[model samples]
Target: MNAPEAVNETDAALLAHAQRLTAQAGRPAPKALTRLAGGRNNQVYRLEADDGPLVLKRYFTDARDSRDRLGAEWSFISHAWSRGIRAVPEPLACDRAEQAGLYSFIEGRKLTAAELTPGHVEAAIEFVLAVNARPRPALAPGSEACFSLAEHIATVERRVARLATLDSEVPHVAEARQLVSAQLQPTWAAVKAGILSGASAEGLALDAAISADQNCLSPSDFGFHNALIDDAGKLTFLDFEYAGRDDPAKLVSDFFCQPEVPVPLAVHEHFIERLTQGLGLDAASVARCRLLLDAYQIKWTCIILNDFLPLGAARRAFADTGAWAERCAAQLAKAEAKLELVGADDTP
Candidate 1:
């Protein structure tokens, strides 16, 4: 694990960055750096140093939206540890200029969907409940008190629209472009109608708003794919770059969305039940989840749809064929089925 990473120009730059971080924190320079895998938004490395193992995450400069994602994550993890919560990686040194931070690596073998058991889901449920028990005001980006489902939907719509702007270099890109275009509107309408129905029945106006009480600070990319299981039989959640006060419903939905972690339907039910029970959710929360199912389903449709976009193809780093294409085809059907799940023209 201490093997030195090859010093490419990028690696050399990271070395300098790491040196600065270590010197600033009064620690020895790292002995080696190992680039980690599977990040689409950030470059991560495991650094071996005299002080022990530290993880460095460098933010992506080309993120679609301009915001201090790095700063927000630092706030989330730092505050969590400040309050004695350590299921997350302990935040260490960071340099805002480099958009990189070091953390104490909670050593563990990252788990895959194949290894997912009810026990793992139970542990994950317990961890999230505790993590969300407190409100992290520092992590909030704006005056908003909670995550906005309407805003999320709007963003997804915009991204789907942007797909048209990307040149269709691959066959999947063209197919996905057509699919998303054909379905996004109807899907969104169904979702909105459901919410309206839920609200109208309760004699309230349809509101796409969720309060912090109904949400929590979430590691937005949370899933078994982003978590690890240590030898001690403990699970650790990873990837907080997208972490912030978010709709709890979104959190659970994202967890189940990852293709790499295939959570069974039974496990999904148990996790949801335990989470709802743990949160002591009221009627509003329950209703919110129901309405949110539409958005989450739509979100996943948008997510897998990305593999068809030019940028998505580039990020996927593979040609749109064979297994990848098959995966896309499956996702396309699944996404379309979402609309059917709610029924056509069916008012929410």
Candidate 2:
């Protein structure tokens, strides 16, 4: 079931390191290596062993936005597993020195919209709620949430400003500039003031308004986009490099915000109704979720333009195909749609 593939010195070293660590964990050394797809921040491969199938992830540091990638992932998942959450890949071994980790491979396919049945949608909602039910896990020493509300509007506003620093003459940059300055900045000032006057840095005054817990730990990116489902219909989630304690509002808003895998409004309605009534969340929390969603919507608008950056273009090998502008323009279009969609949604 393994494919024959070639790897160079860097990957060879990573595989050798994983072998030693897996052996230390009482697992067999990897006998074959086949690079798998669907990763933006790591080199993911199928490591064939006597047990036969496992996943090996090597952090891509050159262009990644996260810090302490391996440490944060290891700590976050370990804490999640310890909390009785279910259906995630089991960690087999981790080597921080090499910035690599091994996990048990799940036999499943990533579910696209066509393959995502109603049952799958229901299960996905349940899984997110369960994650929220668990206590927040500690961030790795040097790690933090992408947009935890504790940092408030100032944090993401600074990131938006950074996107303009390059002043690159790229179409993606032009579109992003238009969106962030013409639209996001003008709207954000008012929203920020409204939110600040309403609550403290911690978050909305949910405690005073309702008995519900404010925000639960998030996988940073929440969606079925990073998940798989087996023949038996079980869901196995993946990707936690950005996982940590996060703002509750971002959690709710991001569930259906991804550009690649869009969620239906009916599904959103079901998810919102369940979380609100089931968790006993108050209106204050709803307002906060809406506020953060507005900010994250703009944040993602800028992120789509990241691939046009100098280092990012090189890391993704855009020069090899020479379609960097095409890709950036496409991402810009997606960002525009995302802005319109989030702006139109009046839920809360």
Candidate 3:
């Protein structure tokens, strides 16, 4: 990450631009700005103003990456706020051309894994229910949203294929190559076969898309990792760059499968029961979710190795996340840990 620098010519120009954008949003101009850390796909800054604080996000864009991140987040937050879902950051303003967005700053500490609790999970579940409540608005599918089981498997395959192409000998490249070729490839094949078998037993087509009602207005990367615990103990969720219409089953799986802020296995059953019941999901959908749990476990394992890919590493570099070798080694360990859990058949 770049160190805080004195206001040089470049800094002055960027700060002025931020202030201009804030003023356009009908918010007070920021008197000062500080670059915030922990962002992995964009540049985030804390903009200080007399009225209060706001967050300025300059999203990462590339010719290879075509997802409209700004549009997805702005639309998702706006719709949720319109529906009286105040558990998320308020969408203040955005400049599509600039790929920048300003949002109400949330004053709270990000939750640690140990800080995760049943209440937090319940609140998250409620947020999901509220977002998907009746009178839903029309929106695009989430970033890489998978409606069918086949799509989910195919997504993992594509990710693994990318990792499979890594031929470098730098840092953890050899370990990642071994994991992908020896472990990930075979594991994915087994997972795909298992998911297909489960789908057949449930009488669901592998490629059949779920009905719209069964779809969710998902905060695609939903979990405590994307949440902050305010002084009032309110869990304010953040980062909806990938949020939009998605499979509720995928949401449920992701909530548990995410490595950071690990939700205990004990809470898994309760979460599944509550979420499935609250969403009014039919038995088949619930069954499908059970089958997809292991599938998503593998998907997340692929996600952990994103740093090994060129575009993925580029995104991390854009966010100023340093220590690439350390991060790659650590991510490989985490991916291996997930593989253990996936093999255990522990989670329902």
The 0-to-1 C-alpha lDDT of every candidate, in the order given, reads 0.65, 0.65, 0.84
**Candidate with the greatest TM-score versus the true structure:** 3
Model 1 ranges with Cα > 4 A deviation? 1-10, 141-156, 182-191, 202-204, 267-269, 307-348
- Per-residue CA lDDT of model 1 for 1-348, tens digit only, reads 112333343568678788788777777888777776555556677777987878878775545445576887788788777878777888878889877888777778767677877788887787777776754464674212235545655655565566555445655556666666677766666776776676678554344566546667677767887777788878877777667776666676667655556555445555666778887665665555545555655666666667676566654552212356676677677666654543322221
Q: Which ten residues in a row have the lowest lDDT in candidate 2?
A: 1-10
Model 1: how far residue 337 lies from native, Å: 9.1
| Cα displacement (Å) at residue 86, model 3 | 1.3
Which segments of model 2 are wrong by more than 4 Å? 1-11, 62-66, 114-118, 132-150, 167-213, 277-282, 314-323, 346-348
lDDT of 3 at 59: 96
TM-score: model 1 vs. ground truth: 0.79
The whole-model C-alpha lDDT of candidate 1 against the native structure comes to 0.65
Error of 3 at 342 (Å): 0.4
Worst 10 residues of 3 by lDDT: 1-10
